[model samples]
Target chain A: MMLEFIQHLVNGLSLGSIYALIALGYTMVFGVLQLINFAHGDVYMLGAYIGMYTAHFFQLGQNSSVLALIFTITVSMITCAVVGFLIEKFAYRPLRKSPRINVLITAIGVSLFLEFSGQLLFGPDPKFFPQIFKPSGDWSIGELKINPLQILVFFISIILMSVLQTIIFKTRLGRAMRAVSFNHDLASLMGIPTHRIISYTFMLGSGLAGAAGVLVGLTYPKIDPLMGTMPGLKAFVAAVLGGIGNITGAVIGAMTLGLAEEFLVGYWAPTYRDALAFGILILILLFKPTGLFGVKQTEKV
Target chain B: MKLLFSSNSRHGIASLRNWILALVLIWMAHFFVADEIDPYFFSIIMYAGINIILAVSLNVVNGFSGQFSMGHAGFMSVGGYISAFATTQLETIYPEWFAHSFLMSLFFIFILVLAGLGAGFVGILVGLPSLRLKGDYLAIVTLGFGEIIRVFILNIDTIGGARGLPNIPALSSFGLLYSWVVITIFCIWRLVNSAQGRDFLAVREDEIAAEAMGVNTTQAKVRAFVVGAFFAGVAGALFAHYLRYLNPQTFDFNRSFEIIIMVVLGGMGSLTGSVLAAVFLTAIREALRSLQELTRIDFRMIIYSLMLILLMLTRPNGLLGTRELIDFIPNGSRKKKKSLESHP
Candidate 1:
């Protein structure tokens, strides 16, 4: 029983980290633009597809080389960054002066556009994510077994998160991002070049989402057009749980959500596993609307 | 006091006559279409009617009350499943002779009302907590509520689970659907034009100010949700019977977005705009069917998403911008009066 619980824990942590990566995209974008950027998930979907294509093109399946995986992930992230940049330039940038609801609706529009276009381009059928490395079994320490892939997932997530933290806290560009998110008009007045900062924020956030996509693809080994929707939604829930605009809060939220889901499916009714995220969301919204780490802001009359 | 009562009765009689006249015209139109027009066209009209109800009711929450609810379809499915279940069970219990009886139609109406009430109760449950939230947060909560409802319904086996509850009897006709549509429009129009509706508008315009002005903003929002959910329920009942099938997938977020599209494309607070937008969008959907067939690709949604984006960009207030069809007519006194009232 203990071994089984450990197994679930390992699995849950790996999944939780992937959600944390995706949730970072939501949190950062929400922080910077105050828009949910609903298309972020679709961008992640595109990244996975791009990674698959890159692997297929280079014929990377025979060798389980770390360099090859890195190359594919890099290519996917760059492409997704460009895609995110373009989406912001065209779709969201024009609506900056509009009502928040209008922008929200447009975001939904962009999301649908990406999803349907993805279906058109990739076809609706699920595709196999090419194995970039040699297929292997779990590494067992006595009774408890751990997949090397889980360790890889956890390590990559941590490295990426640390890199993100450094960028947000220790870098000039990150300062500009924080400034813009604080107040766009004020930031621009301070000569922050707010539009450029916002665009860069999109690229950074979307790049993280792309990396997450590749990671999820490697772990799950299946990619489809609609595959991103559920994970995206759950990650959004995690973002909300962690306080939407708070980075560290998002990561903690993702981990909590992932572990809860794993335990729920493992012990409780598996059928209700999907509903659990929204259930947490409703409960959280009812009790503490600001989220776990979010500071309350009173509206001024 | 005597004079006021006499004027009120006279006004009531005049409205009652108008309602009867509208019903008679609708019945005539229903007969003409049923007997003469193609079944495809009839189905289109029925769907348009349903969309009308969905759009107008959604406008109550989204437009007038200024609350965002992306879960209208969730209430729809609730009503659909409940009404479908009731009909299926009742059909088995009653004789075949009872199916064609006048009493059966009345029973079906009762079931639809019961379904509406059921959905309204759920709306209260969803709205009460979420109403305290503002703007995007409230939107997300409502959206979450919708998804939770869908997922829960998917887990129930007796209602056919993922396969969906099917084989609902077809008790709805063009007349029945449109009559309900008319009733829905009339009720909503009256409610919006009444003194109570001003509170809804006040909440929509600014919740803080509305509260400061002694408006029970929460009650207004909850009322909007209940009214919206109630009519959406009625529409769902009509829709279930019309199609004789009820799939959980039928009332997903996509369906919710489609209804939102109609309300947004129409002037949000305009009753006539909602009706016209429903008809226009439905027509466009049908017109696109030929293109869909030609390409053999489902580009209809692509076009729709593009339209929504473009519409938001260029004309966010939609076609009418909160003005009714009647308001478009050249009425110097009414126009001057409206302008004065708005500015003042």
Candidate 2:
């Protein structure tokens, strides 16, 4: 029983890390624009497709190591950054001054557009991830076993998240982003170039989502147009759980959600895993509404 | 608070006239359309009727009330299950009456009404807490609620699990569906044009301001959700009987979005607009059926989604905006939809 618990904990951490990566995109965009950016998940879906292609063309899937995975993640992130940039430029930017609901509806439209078009372009069938890094089998400690792919997913996600933190807090552009998130009009009044900062936020957030897509593929190995739907929703729940706009809150919320889901799948019914996250979302919104780490602001009546 | 058939209001007369005309048209459809119409065409018309009900009901919450609800399909699915379960259980007890009889049809309508009430109850549960949250949060919570319903239904074994509940009795006829549609539109139209409806519109325009005006914004918002849920439930019951199957997947977020698209495209808060868009979109979708078959790809959904974004960019007020179709029916009476602050 103890070994099984340890195994689920490890599994949870790895899964939570990917969710955190995606949740960052959701939280960042909501922080800056107050738009949920529903297409962010589909952006992650595109990332996996990009990674798959890069692997196929470069012949890196077979007999490749960490370098192959690194290159693939880099290419996917760059491509996804471009995709995210265009989406924000066209889909969202046009409705900046519109009612928040219009932007939201447009976001949903973009999400559906990406999902269906992905099916059109990528074909409806699920593709097997190229397996750039071999799984290296299982390593056992006592009765508990750890999968190397899960370890890789965990290590990569942590490193990326830490880098994100440093950039957001440590750099000049990062400070600009924070300022923009604080107040869009005020930041613009202060000559912060709000549009450019918003663009940068999308790029950074979407880049992380892309990285997550690749990592998820590395672990799960199956990729499809519809793959983003469930994970995207769960990641949004994670973001909400963490206190929507709070960066660190996203990670913590995602970890909690991951552990709960993994434990449910491990001991309880697997079918309830998706519902549990949403159930948590409703409860959190009902009681707290601000999320675990989110700072509350009094609404202007 | 009394609306529709109440003889006091000036607008009531016009709406009552419209309802009578709708009733006549439905009667005409039962006799003319049902018998002479091609089966394919008849089916499309039936679907259009269902879409009309769904769109108008959704418009109650999204259009008139100003609360963004993305989980209407969840309410609809709940209602569908309720009616389906009750009827199926009733079938075992009264196999002969459930087969082909006036008694069975009456019982079916009763079950559908019950479904609407059941769904409305669930909507209250979804809406009460949701009202405390603001715009985007409300939308997300509703979205989650819809997914939770779907996931919950998927886990249940009695309702056929992931495979879906099948073998629902087909009781939908031209008269039945449009009668419900007309009633739904009439009820919603009356509700919106009523004294209470002004509060709903006010809540939509500005919740804080509405609250200050003693509107009881929470009650108004919940009212919208409940009413919307109730009609969505009715629509679901009709839809289940029409299709004679129940896949929880059918009522996923996509279905809710499609209904939203209809409400938006028809011009939010416009009852006639909802009807027009429902018919127009259903027709367009039916036409697109050939394209889907030819390409074997779902470009129809792609186009529908793209149109939503483009429409929002160009005309966020939707095609008809806030004006009624009756405003255009008479010569020189057609007036432009007032450009509200929400649009700009």
Candidate 3:
């Protein structure tokens, strides 16, 4: 029983890290722009597809696996960032002055566009990603056995999270993004091109989403256009659960949600797992409208 | 007090003429469009009318009332399944008692309306808890409620669960569907023109100000949500009877988003716009299906998405916004007066 519990914990952490990555993308964008980038999930989907193509192109199934994996990840991230940038430049930037609802609609439109476009381009079949890494070490400590891949996923995710946090708090671009998110008008007044900052934020978020997509692909070994839908929604829930604008809160929320989902599926029927996440979201909203860490903003009449 | 129709009596008269013309055109289209109309086409048209009802009703809450509800499909599914069960089961159990055609149809419509009321009751139940919350929060709650309903339906095996309820009798005909569509449209038009609708508008425009003016914002919101759910329920009943099959997947978030797209594209807050947009969108979707078969290109949905994005960027208020056809009609005397004033 203890061994099984430990296994579940490792599995949960692996999944939790992916959710945290996606949730950070969501929370960061919401923090800066106050606009929900509904297409973020589609970007993740595209990333996975791009990775699949790269893996196939290089014949990585029989070739040098590590180099192929690195190439796939790099290409996927770049492609996703480019798409995210274009979407912001054309669809969102034009409507920045419009009502928030209009922007919301545009976001939904972009999401739908990406989903269907991906479907059209990739055909509605789930493609298998080449297994680039085989678990090298199976360590048994007491009753628990740990796989190398799980540890790798955890370490990579932690490194990415730390890198993101450092960029947001330490770098000049990150400072500009923070300033823009706080008050776009003030940021613009201070001569910080707000539009450029917004674009960069979207690119960064999409890049993170791309990395998460690649990790998810490696773990699940399946890529489909619709695969991102559920993960994206769960990540959004995680963002909200953590207080939408707080990056650390998003990570915490994602971990909590991931663990909750795993335990629920393990203890109960798997069918109820997605519903469980939504239920948690409803409960959280009922009690704490600002989320676990979100600052409450009062509307002025 | 003047009657609700008095303020815009002249515009009403002109609108009555236009509505009559539109009705005539619809009848003509129904009659002359085909040499031998298949039952399939009739059913599709009937479903289209039902979709119009749902889309328009949703417009009342999401568009006019300025609420973002992604749960209209939940109310629709509730109404559809309940009404289907009622009409079919009650008919089968007591065939001898309800043998009369008129009585049976009346019973069916009655049960359907009651089902809609039940859906409205559920809507109120959902609405009351989160009516005080802000827009995004309310959106999340309603979305959660929608998913919960779907999950509950999926779990209830007695109602057929995930496989869905099937073998329902075809109760709606072309005439019946068209008539209901007319009645629903008229009812919505009247409601929007009434003082109640003004309160709804006030709430939409500025909630705090509306409350300050004694609008009872909570009550107004509940009323809009309940009424919207009621009509959605009716639409669902029509859908169940028309399709003769019902599934939980039919009421998912995508379905709700489709209806929302219809409302947004039609111009939120415009009754005529909602109806027109629904018809246009349904037609476009049908056209796309045919195009897909011909070209072997499955990018129709992509086109739709692009269109939606383009529409938002160019005309965020939608094609019609709050303006009705009557507002644009050439009022010769008013035009002359305006010209005279400008010249002076």
Query: How far out, in Å, is residue B14 in model 1?
Result: 10
Task: Kindly report which residue pairs in candidate 3 clash with one another.
Answer: none
Model 1: CA > 4 A from native: B1-16, B290-297, B331-344
| TM-scores of chain A across candidates | 0.98, 0.98, 0.95
Interface RMSD for each candidate model?
A: 3.2, 1.6, 6.1
Ranking by DockQ: 2, 1, 3
Residue-level lDDT for B267 in candidate 3: 82
How many residue-pair clashes does candidate 3 contain?
A: 0
RMSD of each: 3.0, 1.9, 4.2
What is the per-residue lDDT of model 2 for residues B7-80, given as tens digits with 9 covering 90 to 100? Answer: 53345334466678879988897887679988998899999989999999999898888888899899999999
Q: What pairs collide in candidate 2?
A: none
Which wins on DockQ, candidate 1 or candidate 2? 2
Q: Is candidate 2 or candidate 3 better by lDDT?
A: 2
lDDT of 2 by residue, A1-301 (tens): 8888889999999999999999999999999998989999999999999999999999998777999999999999999999999999999998899999889889989999999999899988899989899966798877678998898899899999999999999999999999999999899999999999999999999999999989998888899997887788899999999999899999999998899999999999998777898899889998988899999988775
What DockQ does each prediction reach against the true complex? 0.54, 0.72, 0.45
Give the per-residue lDDT of model 3 (tens digit) for A27-100.
88888878777888888888888888877787776664556667777888888899889999999999888777
Q: Number of clashing residue pairs in every model?
A: 1, 0, 0
Q: Give the lDDT of residue B94 in candidate 3.
A: 82
Top lDDT: which candidate number?
A: 2
Off by over 4 Å in 3: A64-67, A136-147, B1-36, B95-101, B291-298, B331-344
